[model samples]
Target: MAFEIVRQECMKNPEGRSRPCNPEEICEVLENNQGSDAIQGISLDLSQVGDLQLSADVFRKMPNLMFLKFYSVGVKRSCSVKLPSGLESFSNSLSHLKILWNGVKNFGNLREINLAESKQLTALPDFSAAQNLKHVDLCGNIKSLKSENQLKSLAKLIVVGCYGLKEFSFSSDKITYLDLRPTSVEILDFSTGCMEKLQYLVLNCSRLKYLPINDICCMRRLQSLVLYDIGGLIDKSKLHSLFDALLSLKVIHLDGAFKLTDLPNNTKHLSRLRCLCVSNCKSLQSLSELPPSIEKLGAYECSSLRTLQLTSHFEPSSLADKKLLGPTLCYSVSYLRNLQRLTLKGCEQLYELPEFMDSLSSLSSLDLSESNVESLPASIKHLSNLKQNFLAGLKKTSFSARIAAIPRNC
Candidate 1:
């Protein structure tokens, strides 16, 4: 009973046998099974073949066609489909292909092409003879993209939400991961060199204006720089010369930039910075003094932070010791000694914090929730790996003598 050949039941409609076939009755049932070389695979559902127009050798007599899937459920991008301008007659045994049918111009041994959310795809199709393409997941409404040369085995390129991609250029020097998030790309032109082994770059474009920070400071094996919500068209001296030429940056997410305010005093010499996220940076007020190989620090809802100065020659005299060493409570004092996790949640103009917090010996989570910090620093019982201390929106309740100076298994 293995007569299972359901190419949509060969578009059956001998008077509506469970009706579901148009597009010239499924191109005349693939032109009468073009001699069928035992058709290897073909899964078409372009919304029940609504507007297909095949015949560029309609699968050239199915010579062992590998796999071809054209899916569409709830379709309607004007239901237009026109395949074949380089399935190039199944270039010697077609490999695998999913279709939105823009007539891919030959990518024979295809290795990957997601075509994410096609959204009436705008253009792409000249992958210079693909040569075993590596990875390309493009997002909706792509406006522009130029490649045509130097894709020597692409490594990874994800273009998300292409708004109308303002401008982008690539040549691929073995790209190591480039995510253009929320794109309306305002000219990114990676200075040709093609991101020399780039190691992860997510540009959350807020209409990014331009970027060529000396060819992204010659890459130097970039290690993760997500400019989430990048606004103000990048400035702050080119993000402090791209954090002093990306000294092998470990991770830096400037969440919702909002015109910064301060950060580059050589950001305490990024000695392989571990992680720093300036969450919702509502015009950051001060920070400069961090890189003690940070472990994880998130300044949530910044709201014009005050002056977080941990060290760099600690000098706090007054103004309430600089609002208890502002910037929502600085770090550094003996260099975060490997900070574990410290999130200043909604820093409501942070009131105070630094009584040197016992030099954070590998701090283990401390989030001052909705902060306006009233008090808490008798070195907080010398943290011995404090485990999660998130004071719920404190404005005052004068924490019973700092909760009896913490440490009762904190």
Candidate 2:
């Protein structure tokens, strides 16, 4: 019986392919390369072979190829079948081309292009003439892009989830880093002040509703801004119109802005604003003034934040060791005298807590886990540096303290 079917396909497939490698054995590996007239680099991952065609010259016997990767993984619709185009004759020693999750869609002489998880790439071609392109990382569903004079020596443009891109007018002034996600862009111009070495911006668009930031030509060398989950489409009077020249914004991450109540009552002068991360912003309530150079203030899970304007003339060494306040049902913090890690974990409608809390004095660590905050503020016995999980939420909640002033290794 054909010698037991060739010994069960030669000892159960000794790591050998069953068939799919016949493009004349890919031109006998660029003419065995020793003579070296061609063949620089080439990777052809058939993605486990499917119907197999790939012929447009199969890279024309590799005319001094530079680096080419042709792979195939999955998810490709829209009439499909569009690979093997001849790659414009390797467009001058093709630089570096990476196409993942699917077949070749020609991109010769690239500098750096990574397309990961591509459901079905839509655009990107016409690199003007490939003037030493820079870098472009795409997540999937490209939609189309070929302008900005074909990416004028692009720097780094990352586009994620481009749902057939509604718009994108590039202006790469040697672009720094501009990340755009979930694009169906309603409006995005950055006010036309032009990409002046843009300092890191992640516009996690929730159908972006314009981003002019009170135009006078904005984005003044932005320091770091991540508008994560921008659902309410930017309110707060357009985020106070980006506080004048955007004073090199330090780190402002507005997470899940569901309809912010405030922030930008002129941040009192952002002397390099340190770090203000507002998480789960469930319609923020109050926090009207802040910025003695704000040294780390994370408002996490903000269920309608109640207080924390933090002032005592600000600047208490800028919150010293940092990590100040973030689970607000805010009972008040006597002007946060240099806080050092306060979490109020899960503030379950935080009951009553501000018995001056040992006057903070550089609080060591207090989390009040799953808070309904029963009690424990006999000034926390003068908290000398409160550690032991800050009496571990005074053990089993409702602890009003005075178990002999909590000691004996509590």
- Candidate maximizing TM-score: 1
Residue-level lDDT of model 2, residues 257-318, one tens digit each, is: 87887786776576687677787778886666655455456667677665555533333343
What tens digits encode model 1's per-residue C-alpha lDDT throughout 1-410? 12222334443331121222343444565644342555565555766656675554565555454455667788665455564442323323333333334544555555666555454456677777777678888866667787647787888889878898887888687878988888887777876655678888888878777656788778878999888887665657788898888888899888777778878777777889899888888888877678767998889989788767655554554589567456433434544778888888887887787777677778878887777777777776777788634555555637686666676565
**Global lDDT for candidate 2?**
0.57
Cα lDDT listed for each candidate: 0.69, 0.57
Which sections of candidate 2 miss by over 4 Å? 1-22, 27-40, 43-52, 55-66, 69-239, 243-263, 266-307, 310-410
After aligning candidate 1 to the native by TM-score, how far in Å is the CA of 23 from where it should be?
10
- Runs in model 1 with CA error above 4 Å? 1-24, 28-40, 43-66, 69-125, 128-177, 180-200, 203-213, 217-224, 227-240, 244-251, 254-264, 268-275, 278-353, 356-375, 378-401, 404-410
Model 2, TM vs. native: 0.29
